[model samples]
Target: MRSLLMVSAGVAMLGLTAPAAAQNMPAPMHMMPHDGTLLTVVAEGRTTRTPDLATIRAGVTTQAATAAEALAQNSTRMERVLAALRRAGVAERDIQTASIQLNPQYRYQENEPPVITGYQAVNMVSVRFRDVAKSGSILDVLVREGANNINGPSLSLDDPAAALDEARRDAVARAAARAQLYASAAGLSVDRIVSISETMEGAGPQPPMMVSARAQSESADTAIVPGEQDVTVTLTFRFLLK
Candidate 1:
């Protein structure tokens, strides 16, 4: 009987401890629903700025009865042009030889093989000018120094980061404004930003201006107009709906 009483007391003690342990256990977590609605919108922003740098292509074209004569004349003329550019403040690093070519000139007669008349030689160089205002005077000097073939005054900005940043800000603002408009129309509120992405489009240096060679008397300072260039950015934004 005493042994039976001890076992019964032990069973009662175990039943009391079971409820206490159950009360001390952590509660299960409740997960939020993942089926919320997503709203996305795209917006674009653009900014215009004037170019600050110019690139000019200048060269000499010579024709003579012999290849050696043509090449020699072209070389001498190009040397004078390089000296003039240096005197006008163009650095050696900014001048680069773009092309050198020697070809035979052909004269065609009716019902006969083409006759070689003379040899033509061309030597071209590309020059970068940091000062836009000096481009015209430099071209005049180049023409005076025997640059017969002159083309281009390509204009561009040295740095476009600031303009691009401004465009990005404008894009984000436009996206937010459009999102708010949609949210108000649907009687919903934007709770948070889910994601953002960007696309850069139509942002590059302006097209180059072409200048043809003219007679020395007619060749005044080459007029250069550095027009405005556009910087554009597009943004796609996703906002959570509430």
Candidate 2:
């Protein structure tokens, strides 16, 4: 079916850097849901913000001839890591045990059955840092206290309600702009909005731009650079043109 003046657009994150072309055609009467020309405008709202929180996976891994021995060594190191976290003002609620694993290392032979050589133990926790600026120093302390395996610094906002609301407003504005453009092209004006709805594309914490700190000495330090993440909300607006 032909449209009177169809406007459909896609926007880039952080800003509407690119916009899809708007198409104008002869008005059709059979394919609309209203008396006048029906215009459906789809637009995305986006905002870039520096993350306010960091989630780090810090742990200790140890290998020994037996599972019991490996676990013992890992426990000893993990205690010190916990102590350092508490000393650095990390709240107990922000730290949670992720996993505790013990596996047997096997030596494979060409024709003989596999024989167990040693056992490896790993203890890990998911640590959330509310203060992104100070997380680097805290990570350094964790390293000094015997955290051998560390990863992530998953960046995110503490409370995204405000940012998402901002995006919602942006979407509405974009939809309005596109609708006006459509009305003008079709030799009509925007009468009113027939319907409006939103689609949140799950604008959660961006992927981890991790500064992995692994097997570092006391003299070494870690740094966390919180870049920017895009929070986006997509909206579809149905406007009537008269």
Candidate 3:
């Protein structure tokens, strides 16, 4: 009989301690709002702006009987291209060496062993243009300065944080408006927000465009058309209906 009483007392203590521990635990991100019905809504917000910056890839390819000769020839031409960029007001910090390679050119036959014809060397630099309007003209100069290969004019906003914040605000407003509409339809009032999650959808890159050596954007001039770019934000919101 004494043991039974002691066991009952221990169980009572355990029950008290369990409640206290649960109260001390941190709240979950998606905690229910006092047993109210939850209403979830998803919406998207998009903002459009013209790109203000651009990136271009320019390089030279050289061939020679020896790897050393090919590399030397490539290095000289690449220097000319770099100088042209400098003359065009391109900052040194804006130019980055993307790649340099020397490979043996091989001629393959069906039954015979492959023969090494010559060595080819390639050097490339990635250049950023702060002013997209002048980028095309500068590219023409690069081609004239012995850049044999060119690709891209990847356009983007210089700073996207402000635009993204605007998008977020739009997303929140859209989600709340949608949830409120649902609450009204169900004859319930929106009590509080349970949770919110967001996804950023940035603009996609432009297709890769290539220009041969000395080729210009147009006759006697070059033009860069920066079409409108869209930045999107998607949000899911959970609200409690009282």
Candidate 4:
């Protein structure tokens, strides 16, 4: 019995000492040193290409005394617009109704409750024109049929792979140029590139700087300029300093 008691006491002491030993152990090592010097740099690149695709939004609106009448009128005008789109070689899938809303019109009165005047229904459709060259004629036809609301002929590149490749090449060149500049300023030389990361920012028609699209409200024939699109790429690179 005395031998068993001594064994139990030794086991208890070992358990207590194990916890204390673990608490005194150092933490695991990290891959990078805390005092290591690193450089952070950003490089930007842009490429311009003519847009090949055009997107537009068109629709009709109607107002009547009753909601049913307003809706019917809106539906008729929208049907006519769709028909016009079909006639212009726009496929069924390319034409889609984007918005349809019906709300009651209100009239304000001095020191009195608001009164309902009429119900207005608005229907908007988004159309994609693969052939951007003939967009003017299409707009004319849509307006003649009953379309009153037209948004834009937003242009874009159909295949942006070539432009993206150009942008990436430029980005790398920019990164290298910046690294060299920093190295020269610090009286060092860039030995090797340790890591490279890239992010794509924008790939669409460039914003209008001097010229804007003419509004359809003033004229039936819409003039579109398939201007240049800007594709941009940004990159970050880590270079080893020597």
**Winning model by lDDT:** 2
lDDT of 4 by residue, 94-204 (tens): 788889899999999899999999999999887878888888678888877888877777788878888998999998897788767766666667666656778987686
- Please give each candidate's TM-score: 0.78, 0.84, 0.83, 0.78
- Provide the RMSD of all predictions against the true structure, rounded to 1 decimal: 18.5, 6.6, 11.1, 14.8
lDDT of 1 by residue, 58-100 (tens): 9999999999999999999999999999999999999999999
lDDT sort, best first? 2, 3, 1, 4
Best by TM-score: 2
lDDT of 2 by residue, 1-242 (tens): 21233456542111111121112322242434434556778889988788998998999999999999999999999999999999999999999999999999999989999999999999999999999988888888888888888878788888889889999999999889988876776678898886777898646666765444453454455567887888899987778677
Clash pairs for candidate 2: none
The full ranking of all candidates by TM-score, starting with the best, is 2, 3, 4, 1
* 144 Cα displacement, candidate 4 (Å): 0.2
C-alpha lDDT (0 to 100) for residue 141 of candidate 4: 81
Off by over 4 Å in 4: 1-37, 205-220
Flag regions of model 2 displaced more than 4 Å. 1-6, 9-34, 214-219
| CA deviation > 4 Å runs, candidate 1 | 1-33, 215-219
On TM-score, who's better, 1 or 2? 2
